[model samples]
Target: MADYLNNNAGMDWDDAIENDGQEFIILPEGDYNFTVTDFERGRFPGSAKMSPCNKATLTLQVKTEDGIASIRTDLILNRVVEFRISAFFRCIGQKKHGERLVMDWNKVVGSRGRAHFKPRTYTDRDGNERQANDVDRFYDYDEKNFPAEDDWMEITGDADDLPFN
Candidate 1:
């Protein structure tokens, strides 16, 4: 591993080239915990699936049995795919059921969530087959959305329960 860069001083390209690069990980189909490592906003040209629109590219660090897998996913920001945008916010606790929330991309990084990942096979433009990971669903694991049982009060209102309350 190379030493941390302080101010780009003493940087050597040949020396850095010796360091090994990250390995590609394709996990089996299952749910996994993932953190938003990076976020980028970009425009998407019109495709046959949908019209041109803005998109959010997310770099997720997914925890897998082998190790942490880096998966890059693009989220198209359109009403046609609004469910996916809502799911991401709900999973990260930014949005709750029956509530409205502003899309805050600033806080997206470092947010944690659970999602289902599946292996997908596709052909490259060069005519080569490749295997990659795809997100099946983003789950809502926000604790604040669901009140705990202990926080609930049974409305019997017994005299003895009054003291405990």
Candidate 2:
């Protein structure tokens, strides 16, 4: 194999991509159109606020002026997390008022609606103050009353034509 380390004669520290000191855009504190882009399972180490628990990481794509912003929310799988789960299902076009219904969580990936984002501030590892966006709640969006662009676009085409394929 060729020695790759010997080919960096013109390399400079200033030309390197800076991953640190990156700015995080905080969404304005308000309701915005959002979609459930992905889901993941994670574990939380023991903490003073609560015991270690399994959490469902729901990645949300919120519509913003610049395009879209990704925000993650961890829902601990415990008794206290029922309300959040229920609200999430309801936002995905599930009926809440009349009769009980079963929700297929797997099909919730393309669910879109209005999500309330709240501003949260915390100290970073370097003792620097940082701002983050938190999902407060989700609401059923009325397309008739307030029509907006659908965040998740459904592509009806051959699967083989996809770039990933």
The TM-scores of all predictions, comma-separated, are 0.75, 0.67
Residue 51, model 2: Cα distance from true site in angstroms: 4.7
lDDT of 2: 0.71
Model 1 lDDT at residue 127: 100
* TM-score for predicted model 2 compared with the true structure: 0.67
Model 1: residue 106 alpha-carbon error in angstroms = 0.5
After superposition on all CA atoms, how large is the RMSD of candidate 1?
Answer: 11.3
lDDT scores of the candidates, listed in order: 0.80, 0.71
lDDT of 1: 0.80
Tens-place lDDT per residue, model 1, 1-165, is 012134336656666545475689998998877778788899989788889999999988875567668888999998899889999999888998767888999999877788899999999999999999998899996554433552222456678777665
Superposition error at 8 for model 1 (Å): 10
Candidate 2 lDDT, tens digit per residue, 1-165?
Answer: 012235425756668663363245689899887777777778867577678887788888775676567788887766556677767776766657444666576776766767789989999999999888899887754565235654345577999989998
